[model samples]
Target chain A: MTLLTSAVAAIVCTIIWYKNAPKNDMKIGILCWMYWGATIMWFVDAIFEYAELKAEYFSPAPADMLNDFFLGLSVVVFGLIIWLVILLIKDPKGVIKSALSKKAN
Target chain B: MACFLISTAEAVVTTVAAKQIEKNENLREVNVSEVKYSHKTPFSKKLKWLRNMLWGGSALLLFEHVWHGEIVPFFPFLTAASNPADAAEMLHEMATVGVTMALLVTGVWGVIVGITTAMEKKAEKEDAAQIAEHAEN
Candidate 1:
């Protein structure tokens, strides 16, 4: 489930990036890279879990699937938070900078 | 703190992006640091909305998880599950609720981007007309 969710997210972000490739915004590219990175991380995790569980991995119990699902969502959410923080720091669009300067004056 | 980490990450991201851009001969000598992203660019405006959507959606989801007792500051929360039936229900909630929230955020961002783009175009045309009128005088 983790693998599937992350892959879906990576694919969605990739498609968006592809459509806007000419513009090539850094923020969008960063987001795409983040999701793809997460997907790879979960892929490796799935491989390890499969190795440990062998056949049982192929038929994960509902509880195991649910756990994996939550884990995947957590990873996705964490990725967004990290991205948001970066966006805030960079103030890529100058929104935060203007807001802060306005508050200062 | 998170501010320090994000500043570090920002350096890494900017370096990577600049390196990628440098591969293009035309932009090879461009100073990435000197190039500040303008607030008025269409991409920037759209990204502003997207940032809001994602941050808001993630916050809402966290609140939901906390309310549902799925999240805790302990290891048990990582493995929370009552039984097979309960797990199935949880899976259903994740699929339905999680997907809906993501979709809602994306949909709103898309719509606002479309509207803003159109409005910007209209404003640009009006400005052009005014310049042409002034030049004729």
Candidate 2:
């Protein structure tokens, strides 16, 4: 489920990015990269987990699946936090910079 | 809240930027009404991408959880002790694998954007030079 969750996310984000790709918005592209990166990480994770669990992987206990779901959500939220930091630094629209300059006056 | 204060400050600044762009760009600016809050600069598309990623990732995760019955109202996962299968070990994994994944993603993204932006600027310079040469000829 964890692997699949990240994979699904990567697909969705990729589709959105591609649809408006002509705009090639740097911020959005970065986001697409972030999710694709995560999908890779989770893919490796799932592979190793499958090797260990084999057919057992087909039927995880309900409790374990729930726990994995929460962990997946946690990662998503963490990604958002990181993206926010990037945005702050980039100040793409010069919003934060403009705000700072205004205060100096 | 600190977030609210920061947002307000951002709004004030963006409004000023929008006015400047309006004067200079001849209103070629997109999201004019939102100029004061979050106008689309050359890099703003990435911000849109980020928003979509968060929503899409979140929705997919939720859908998977629901399908697996791991997130049913009947099962209360809020209680950690009730689900020992995902606590200590998961925490360990989160700290190790989770943190590493986040850092790796961020680092890779930073490098990619840096390289691409440089390449883009270089191409633009070449194009301008070609135009000038043609005009001179």
Candidate 3:
């Protein structure tokens, strides 16, 4: 549920960025990549849950799969957060300027 | 950008339809000043009406899904329950969190759409007024 909630948050942020930002802005591309990365994490989490449900058929243990999935996803989401933060910090004025210019036209 | 393009297209179609209807009615030079204002109705009142109509519809649909037990199978935690009453209680608990997240997503999207639409309308009105002034000159 936490994973899905975070994914929902990312989706909302993406939609807001798309609607308000400049058309075809490079930042949108970055945001989209981040969204897809998060989505992958969500799917991985779901798969782990499903595996746990069918533990009789699976041999290697659900705990291992869950741990690996969580570690991978956490790393990916962390990296995306860093990237997004750096983007927001660097050239913040330029982002607004481009968006405003597109709006004006 | 896709949403903006679609909105602009809709605006164009609306304006064209309005012009055609006005022509058919044989109205000459429709004036904004001719519109009447009611003291009892305020802009906020109209906005509240619109918000209720739109957001209320969405909320009803979401609640319907909850009532029907449609969202239960999606979460693995809820699937462990066998009894209907227990499942309902579990779903009710999960729904508090799920609905809150969904509302957050939808609310943000609505605000973005509203702002974008408002900006587009302002630009279109400015453009139309400019054209009218040029024609007069």
Question: If scored against the real structure, what TM-score would every candidate get?
Answer: 0.44, 0.44, 0.32
Per-residue CA lDDT of model 3 for B1-137, tens digit only, reads 01111222333454465456546444432544465432223333333323322222232223323333543546442332656776676555445433443344335445755776677677777877887999999
The candidates score, on chain A by TM-score, as follows 0.83, 0.86, 0.46
Give the TM-score comparing model 1 with the true structure, all chains together. 0.44
Best by lDDT: 1
Show where candidate 3 strays beyond 4 Å: A1-105, B1-79, B82-89
| Model 3 lDDT tens row, A1-105 | 334544664576568767877654344444443443334333443554566578653444677656545544453455356556656666455976687799999
Shift of residue B70 alpha carbon in model 2, Å? 24
User: Tens digit of lDDT per residue, candidate 2, span B59-102?
Assistant: 43334445454455554532322556756654565565444443
Worst 10 residues of 2 chain A by lDDT: A37-46
**Residue pairs that clash (backbone atoms under 3 angstroms), model 2:** A25-B45, A25-B46, A26-B46, A27-B46, A27-B47, A28-B45, A28-B46, A28-B47, A28-B49
- lDDT of candidates 1 onward, in order: 0.57, 0.55, 0.46
Better of 2 and 3 by lDDT: 2
lDDT score, residue B95, model 2? 60
Question: Interface RMSD for every prediction, one decimal?
Answer: 12.2, 6.9, 14.3
- Model 3 Cα RMSD, Å? 16.5
DockQ each candidate and list the results. Answer: 0.03, 0.09, 0.04
- The local lDDT score (0 to 100) that residue B41 gets in candidate 3 is 30
